[model samples]
Target chain A: MDLTFAPEEEAFRAECRAWLEANVPRGLPSGDTRDGFGVHLEWERALYGARYAVVSWPEEYGGRGASAMEWLIFEEEYYRVGGPQRVTQNGIFLLAPTVFEFGTQEQKDRILPRMAAAEDLWCQGWSEPNAGSDLAGIQSKAVRDDAGGGWRLSGQKTWTTRGAFCTHLFGLFRSDPEAERHRGLTYFLVPLDAPGMTVRGFGRLDGDEGFAEVFLDDVFVPDTDVLGEVHQGWGVAMATTSSERGLTLRSPGRFTATAARLIELRRERADPHDTRLRDAVIRAWTDAEAYRWQTFLTVTRMSAGEQLGAESSMTKVFWSDLDVRMHELALELLGADAEHDDSGWMKGYQFALSGPIYAGTNEIQRNVIAERVLGLPRK
Target chain B: MQFAFTDDQLAFRDAVRDLLARECPPSVVRDAWTNKHGRTDTLWTRLGEMGVLGAALELTDLDLVLVFEESGYFAVPEPIVEHVAVAVPLLPEPTRAATGAITAVTSLEGQGAVAYGNSADVVVAGSDAGVELLEAFEVTTLPNSVDGSRRLGQVSSSGTGSGVQIGDRDVFRRAFDRGALGTAAQLIGLTRRMLDMTVAYVSDRNQFGVPVGSFQAVKHHLADARIALEFARPLVYRAAWSMSEEDPDASVHVSMAKAAAGDAANLTAAKALQCHGAIGYSYEYDLHLFMKRAWALAAAWGDASWHRSRVGRAIL
Candidate 1:
């Protein structure tokens, strides 16, 4: 029940804050635009150079090998200092865990350092035009290239986050077409530069091409590119999804910072006596603090070697919904300027709309919660 | 830092759960509704014997949190929250044993009725001078509340009995926060029970030739309720933890926990009742027992708006 940090964790936080205050790039691009995307990539490289990119990974992987609590402290300090969003998030948070868990020694030794340095920007390829929430409904296929000792991958993965700038993608493909859903799929990493591969960027709700449709037309991938056993992609992909929804993707620090900003906005622009706005502001802060406490609880358990399991679905539902509500409250506080203003609140409002839709829709997350956490029968 | 309860705390929880399972069954809860004072003296005596009533002074805040949760889960008809979380902490040790089902006075000028007011042996009210403990006979009692499990009464200032001034404003403030935090924990426990009941019912009951639980609408409703409860649980526990540590921000944390848990518990009651359909509406059903308890507890201590205002004052 203790909330106080250990001395070492506090020292680590101080170090992180000191480094961020000294080295964090100023007037950097927002990463929502094409020009800013490159600057964001460079910022990630700078983070890697400072050994602050992946705090929880092993030192060999260019991380500090910090404990989970220290990592949380790093985040708290990082966000407090107004650190830019991690541009290498897809590579660092989602895919890196899978690579560490399922990649061969050769793969880890080869890919992780490059990933940490932003030399090989990565994007996820989980959903398609037809397989949004129903991930197993993916029609992507990969056939073994016996002559070349590789596989010929052909698929169109839509909603590929950061696909416009990423040089590589890791996706699930139907390796054994004869098998039923989720059984015969294979997890593979493909280079976007491979022959016959094209990335067509799409505008997101925030009017940014951060998301793209990646088309793989018989792109050749070596056997070394396979993440895990063929026909066992679902199990491997679940690992990444859990990390995406559960741990690193939406850290409590982001919401805490956002909540602090919302309060600032209310104090600066909102009427002091407006009880409705006051209540919403308070709720936003409370929800964010609740999330922070919950994450602390989660980190403590994980530090003690506990597995999070399908309970991550509940976390996904909670933060995603809270993020949207917080953003909405920010907009409400903006009042008439909510729609027409060029404030950061407008962009955040647009971005918050996608939280529930991504990492599996809230609807799908609920089904997962109901079936796995509550032991309810599947529909 | 560890957030999970220790083995001893868990054992205490299990003991409370076992006691409630054995003594506070649905039949017994239903009987309490019809009793003269809307609660059983035996249960109160057993609680006192178990030292549950004295936990405010004896147990750590975290331990009392686990205890209060079980009280809420069982929908215990007694004024345990008022006794353990509020009165005992404000009153001195010599008077604690003499107190029977203590009720709170949030405002001296308000309706002045407290839960189980008629049954209380002690009426503790905080005022400008100090915290005062008056005998139940000192305050006029008006019975019949929305929640029938515990009797409620309106009190007036003119009573014949002399009062005992035990503590000051700070002591009373801490007791108030404890009462709110206790109610928050109870709301969370009550929400868990409501969600569990609905989950079980939806799985067994079929509609349109399929189990209703399989329907996304029903599942989503239950799922939202579950998410709310899950998120609120940590807040309640952390609030307890904060209070146990005597953190300066403990009051704010308690208010946050109360606001979140009250909103979540009310939603759980509504969703559970809606999922149960017609059967849930009947007084004969067990769902109403918890539903009524949820309504009562949500308004008790400090309601959602009251707590939210507290949070706004602190943070905003």
Candidate 2:
């Protein structure tokens, strides 16, 4: 199907382009830091204050109440200007949506405004060292703190991205040791200010300490902080992970930008009819461009409220695989220069390796396709 | 992102499956492959009558990927690609068959008689001149070593009219590209069939009181085969589609498809054979039927490395 924006949508895109031209300041801080988020927070708050908080959300909850297609245009522009990723990602992308569907009025009132303003930064607490894909195997414990009118939690959360800097975390803990693996868990919003909370940096494949190993000991939470119904954390957790899959991936246009850079790089070293070199260029272009196209399809599907089911898995698989293909081309085209470990091409190659592991590994995705889509006999 | 095949395609695929099952049945494959210098002229005529011979070729462009896919599906026991791809499509079809494989050549521009000792039945060769020299007449050639099941004959050149010759630049180029694409598609078909057969076999065959397919190692390897098949499907289809559309990118796509298809076929067929173990290599087993097809297809247009280098040269 053709993928041109509608006339009205195109007009909306132009308007957003102008607005982004006016906003999105130059020379901003990078990485996951307080200062980095400070400007990001101010920017979001300004947008939110102007009724641009949640493009697809209901106006009742600090949002523009826009259509999904319009929201897509907004996101497209955000990435176009090299705008900051949603700094309070936990609130905007994950928790708020869940809360909007399931939270009480008090929870909504107390949380929505602050989240919109970036006054609070939130990290996810899903994985323990033991429970990544087998998430129901959580080892974290949360005892009823009746005297404090809530709960006291104790646990270690690894791969807690941005945990060291974020002010809050949304987590699922084992609130009832006697309950079943999934049924016993309860979702909670925990503030880092709570006693015995510690965040320690950990190295990631990306060579950044953006992720942390967070320790929570005797951390107190008021009754109001509990999210959704107790022992039903699995459902909410799945929702969060699926949302993360949609929102956290590098934008398709990001690859477009990379492709532009590549075209420039190849220009200096290439000649027409250099078959090997030309072949490499075409392969690179196809892999990246196709994946980018496929991912854009996924985005459009999500906006249309279509459950891609295993197609979503297919998308995840495609981007990672394509990234690897692109990296291979980058290395080949670079010739002798590819040997440099610090080279951008090399870094891309290394980074592409994580693709299959995260957002569910390719093996896992294939399994999903086999079972859910292909209807292959599991045996 | 969307992998749904349309209803029309689904029906078309179903028809192909049925035809292959009945006409290109495993028994037929067994018979054809077991003998030396084998052929099924009757079946080819039947397929041609049904228009299935050109089912994959689009009228818009000389897209041959469709035909290639069918060849892969059935592991069809013929040099359909070479005939349809390299000769009929590239040169003139129904070029006069001579008593022997050899005939006289009017020009040296063609791949010299394609018939060594005996003359070639139909020799469509490329020339530097704008015109492709196609000669057809009653020609005969000496028999050569039967490398494949099909009988081998050699064709020769002399200033004679034993073989018919026609001059057409368009036909030669179209046929050449089609031949390459078709061979690639046939390999894709063969490998796909091998993988399917292996999957079905392993799922049924038991060891240690369990189906072999249930084993993790078996599943992973089968998965690998499936991956190979999938990775090349788009390549094959895109190339075919390009030819059908006569897209400027046809060569690029065709080269990739041919290269990918060759590798996938070779690797997947070998792996499938391994999964079937000793039985696969035995003469009586059905695995050889597919394997031979793969082997033949690989050598038909170009081998894997050749296509790969071509792809490299084009892209790099």
Most DockQ-accurate candidate = 1
DockQ score, prediction 2: 0.10
**Chain B TM-score for each model?**
0.92, 0.78
Candidate 1, after superposition: displacement of residue A278 in Å?
A: 0.7
What TM-scores does chain A show, candidate by candidate in order? 0.97, 0.83
lDDT (Cα, tens digit) per residue for candidate 1, span B250-309 = 999999999999999999999999988898898788998898889888887778888899
Q: Which candidate achieves the best lDDT against the true structure?
A: 1
- Once fitted onto the true fold, the runs of candidate 1 whose alpha carbons sit more than 4 angstroms away are B93-112, B156-162
Clash pairs detected, candidate 1: A1-B2
For residues B238-285, write the lDDT of model 2, one tens digit per residue. 566567667666666677777777777878877788878787888777
Docking class of 1: medium
DockQ of each model vs. true complex:
0.76, 0.10
What is the per-residue lDDT of model 2 for residues A1-379, given as tens digits with 9 covering 90 to 100? 2344678778878987787778876665544555565666777787777666566677776776776567766767766675655666667877877787678899998887677667777788878999886778898989998888999899988777777777898898999899877888989999877888998876567665667888999899988998888778877676665665543344455555455556556776566557666655555554544444445555555655776455455556655776776777667667888887454668667767877776667776666544454343467
